[model samples]
Target chain A: MVDLILGWTGVVLVFIGVFFLFLGALGIFRLPDLFNRLQAGTKATTLGVVSTTIGVGLIAKGWLVFSLALAIFLLMTNPISSHALGRASYRAGVKPYKGTNPDLYAEKVKKESDQK
Target chain B: MRIEIPQFIWIAWFVIVSIATILATIRAIVGPTNSDRAVGLDTWTTITTGFWVILALYFFQYILLSVSMVYAILSFLGVLAIARYLERGL
Candidate 1:
């Protein structure tokens, strides 16, 4: 009975995971600008995919422990990848809010310099 | 008795993943710059890589796990190459 319940739970979780993933992709295509799209796409997918992956790990049973490790690795790496992408985007000169907003990174650097 | 997933559900998952792949393609194609496309492509490859692992698990095929290894290597290369190009203007 427990196994069956877990399996059903896993299925539902995976289905929900898929839905969020679709939202992530839609954010990528439908958002107005690169900044908005990246924020929407990256944030949704990091959590969505990791959640689905864990559900898959649960359903796949005991022998595929490596698969579980990989899923955990993905959970760790997705955020890092997004951080790297954001930094790269900023360095490449993609301005925020169509260049109207102040640059946060530059402001932080200025504040740190003044403190020293 | 052996258990099986409904064929329609399996096919539905495939279609959903494929739609995601297509959307990623759209991002890559319509991207305003190289970095934008690179981000899209990176996520696309990662998702496809995850799909491979899911298929392996669904089939209970141990050999198919090797695909994950290949994906790991390629993922690192994708990120490294893109970062390098972005840094030095390749």
Candidate 2:
């Protein structure tokens, strides 16, 4: 009975994960600038991977450890990499989308150069 | 091989993911700037990681899980390297 329940749940989780991935791809296409693109790519894909991994763990015996570790790794590394990509793109002079407010990064960079 | 569920589910999953990948590839190709392409590549790698895990589960081969893990690390490092290069041109 438990196995049957797990199998169904796993299927549902996989479907949900795929939905997030679909949205991520859509966001990439629709978003105007690199910053927004990275935002969607990182956040949605990370959640998708996490849920899918855990769901797979529940469905398969003896895979729980591997799946949990993968989930943790995804959580830890994804955000860091996203930040790096965004910062790099900004520093490399990829212009922000029109109407982007705040521009905190620009102010920080200016402050740092002035400090030096 | 006896299976209770419809095998087409597996095919459908792969097809959906493949479509997503193709869309990402389109973005990469049409991306006007280098950073856009970089984001595309990053998203592609991230999607592939989950895809490999699903493949491993379907084939009942556990070793592929470890391979996926290694692939994830490699992709992460590669993106960081590319980002660094893009940042300073070094």
DockQ of each: 0.42, 0.60
Evaluated on CA atoms against the true complex, candidate 1 attains a DockQ of 0.42
Worst 10 residues of 2 chain B by lDDT: B1-10
Residues A55-107, candidate 2: write the lDDT tens digits. Answer: 77766777879989988998899998889999889888899999999887898
Q: Model 1, which residues run further than 4 Å from truth?
A: A106-116, B1-3, B69-73
Compare the candidates by TM-score and give the number of the best one: 2
- Provide the lowest-lDDT 10-residue window in model 1 chain A: A55-64
Candidate 1 residues A1-78, lDDT tens each?
Answer: 655666666666666666667677778878767667777777776666666666665666663376667666666666
- What TM-score does candidate 2 get on C-alpha atoms? 0.93
Which regions in candidate 2 have their CA more than 4 angstroms from the true location?
A113-116, B1-3
Q: Each candidate: fraction of true contacts kept? A: 0.20, 0.56
